[model samples]
Target: MVRISEFQIKDVVNVADGKKLGNISDIDINLQTGKIEAIIISGTGKILSLFGKEEETVIPWKNILKIGEDVILVRFNEKNEFHIQEEE
Candidate 1:
C-alpha cells in the first residue's frame, strides 16, 4: 500500500500509444472495501472541454500502466474512451 500524498495532482498520465490522457486531480476509493479504486484526471486542453465539457475522468485502478515517482501512466477502458477529462 502506498500513500496518496506521495503523488501529486496535475501530473501527466500517458497511454501505450503515447497519447497524453491528462493530469491526475484526485483518486477514488471504495469506502466499503477501503481500497483504492480509480484515478481522476482533468483535461489537458481547452478544445476538448468545448466539445465534451469534461470535468474529470474516473479511471479504474486496473488500467494503470505504471506509477512513477512523479507521474502515473494509465490506460482507460474502451467503453470510457475519454480524450481528456478536465477538472473544474
Candidate 2:
C-alpha cells in the first residue's frame, strides 16, 4: 500500500541508459479499472533544453520495473517514448 506522495520524491532512473528521467509530477489512472496507466515525469530545467522548454516523459505502467525506497527503476527506450513538452 504505497501512497502517491511517496512516488513524487523518488527519482526515476532508466535501466537501459541509466538516465535520470526526473521525479514524477503526475500519474494517469484508469477510472473504471482503478489502476495506474502511466507515470508522468516532468523534467527540471536543463542547461540546454529544446526551444527552452522542459519535457515530460510518460512511462507506461508496464515499463516500470521496480519501485524502491529512493528510486524507481524503469526500462525506458529513448527512441520509443511518449513525451509531452511544456509550451511557454
Candidate 3:
C-alpha cells in the first residue's frame, strides 16, 4: 500500500527523453470511480517560473508505465500536450 506522502517524494521522469519532470504535486482522482485519473507534476521549466507556471502538467494515468522506489517512469508527448479531463 503506497501512501500519498510516499508517492510525493518520488521524481517523475519521462521515459522518452529521460527528462526529470519534477515531483508529484497533486493527483486528480475520479471520485465517482474512486480511481486516480491523472497525476499533476510541478511546472518548473518555465522562464517566468519564479512567478509560477501558467499551468501545471497533468499527465494521464495511462501515460505512467512504472513506479520505482525513487522514480516514476511515464511516456508522454514531447510537445507537452497533456490530456486534461473535462470538468463536470
Candidate 4:
C-alpha cells in the first residue's frame, strides 16, 4: 500500500510516446466507492504562464500501466488527447 503523498513525489510518464507528463499534483476519488478515479498532473509553465493560462492534465486511472519506485508509467492511444482544464 502506498500513501497519497508518495504519488506526489513520483514522476508520471507516458509509455506510448515516452513523454514525461509531470508529477501528480492532485487526484480525483470516488468518495462513495473509496476508489481512485484519476491522477491530475499540474501543467508546466509556458511563456504565457505569467497570465495564469496553464491547464491541468487529467489521466484516468485505467490509463496507468505501472507504478514504480520513481515513476508511474501510463499508456494512451496515439489519438488520446489529455483532458485539460483550468486549475482550481
- Report backbone clashes per prediction: 4, 0, 0, 0
- For each candidate, what TM-score against the reference? 0.63, 0.86, 0.80, 0.84
Q: Which ten residues in a row have the lowest lDDT in candidate 3?
A: 79-88
State the local distance difference test value for candidate 4.
Answer: 0.84
Worst 10 residues of 4 by lDDT: 45-54
Best by lDDT: 2
For model 4 the TM-score comes to 0.84
Q: What residue pairs clash in candidate 1, if any at all?
A: 42-86, 43-85, 43-86, 55-86
Tens-place lDDT digits, model 4, residues 12-88: 99897888988999999999998999988887864345556666788889999899999999885536657575643
Rank candidates, TM-score, best first.
2, 4, 3, 1
- Candidate 1 deviant stretches above 4 angstroms: 45-52, 77-88
Which parts of model 4 are misplaced by more than 4 Å? 46-49
Model 3 Cα RMSD, 1 decimal: 4.5
Question: Which scores greater on TM-score, model 1 or model 4?
Answer: 4
Better of 2 and 3 by lDDT: 2
Report the C-alpha displacement of residue 80, candidate 4, in angstroms: 3.1
Please give, for residues 10-44, the per-residue lDDT of candidate 3 as tens digits: 99999899999889989999989999999998655
Question: Residue by residue across 1-88, what tens digits does model 2's lDDT show?
Answer: 9999999999999999898989999999999999999999987774364567777899999999999999999999978987887865
